[model samples]
Target: MSFAEEAWVPTTETECRIEGWSKETHQHGLQVRSSAEMNAQVVGILPAYVINFDSHNFGIEFQIIGSDRGWLKIRGAKDDPNRSKLPIRATYPGIGWIPGEQVAFMVQSGSGHQRPDAESAKLLDLKGDWLTSMGKIVRVVACSGEWVLLDYSLGRSRNPQTLALKRLTEAERRASQGRAWFRGVCAIQETSCETSWP
Candidate 1:
């Protein structure tokens, strides 16, 4: 079945209310009024993948089951054996709700196109400092707004860096057009890298 036809399953653990508190009051040694109040309770913390974006710890990864406005309902992965085995449609335990800005999609392998003619792409900071003179081809791992998370080797080790979408030159932009990952991300936000600033 196609992805659109598949049913969404909730796999994450979330905070839920199981029971409420009750209070009773007595006047003149007789029960005058008994009141029951609801209390908010928290479930155990769910396991989540860490998103390394500018060393920020606010980012997390979860299975997106639903979305409303700018919030997303995310649950843990179904394949995780450590997670609780629950029914997919059960809503007794809710999932997490985070802002849309904290979530990014992963670029699967073989989904990216190649530009053999493009030898290397330049890396520049927001202030225009050339981070790499001869940067290797990197894959787009995740994207948020106008920034894309790239995995590239600086010297001997590989590292991830967040780059502005407009940093690429005209030629570089043309070269990256063949990449499926870039195209998918560009469809979300309109950004051009053809500027001649640096």
Candidate 2:
């Protein structure tokens, strides 16, 4: 299936940050739109929302709440819990649009959530504007509060280089039933993330 199709896989993450790798190379911000279309409508802008020239990558770690014509529909922080705010009023204020350019893709916290975040999912992996921690890659089986469940079949044969997969004893294996919870992220990373599991 296409990215847009798999992006909203129920368990898929739905959050992302628009920024460049570094400020020295990138010195621009993202233009929030009313829709995904280029000519849709200029609602607001995310200051410093960047684009790295050295590394042509955009979409990184985030919970993708939306996917349409390459646009990711994410949640916007409202001024108050009352929810009376919109773009132009704030940076990416309310569920606005951020063009999915270059390498527009979303991922979880490496082993953050092996699966996708539900409607209440916010996997941007953004800690107040700083990109950090690239965890391992694992297929998500389940997710709890602040924890993600991973799936790795240690059956007759298993791949040693399966990213963040870990070896478990017969008891542990049976307990996990070929599934285990490891620390990782699903958000796509330009480099890689570490998965602490076994």
Q: What TM-score goes with each of the models? A: 0.23, 0.33
| Model 1 score (lDDT) | 0.28
Predicted structure with the largest TM-score when compared to the true one: 2
lDDT of 1 by residue, 52-144 (tens): 344432112234444333334445522222222222321213344443343443221212212211122322222332222223323333222
- Where model 2 places Cα greater than 4 Å from the true spot, the runs are 1-28, 49-63, 77-90, 102-198
Scanning candidate 1 in windows of ten residues, the lowest lDDT window is: 17-26
Best model per lDDT: 2
Global CA lDDT of candidate 2, please?
A: 0.36
What is the Å distance of residue 30 in model 2 from its true position? 0.5
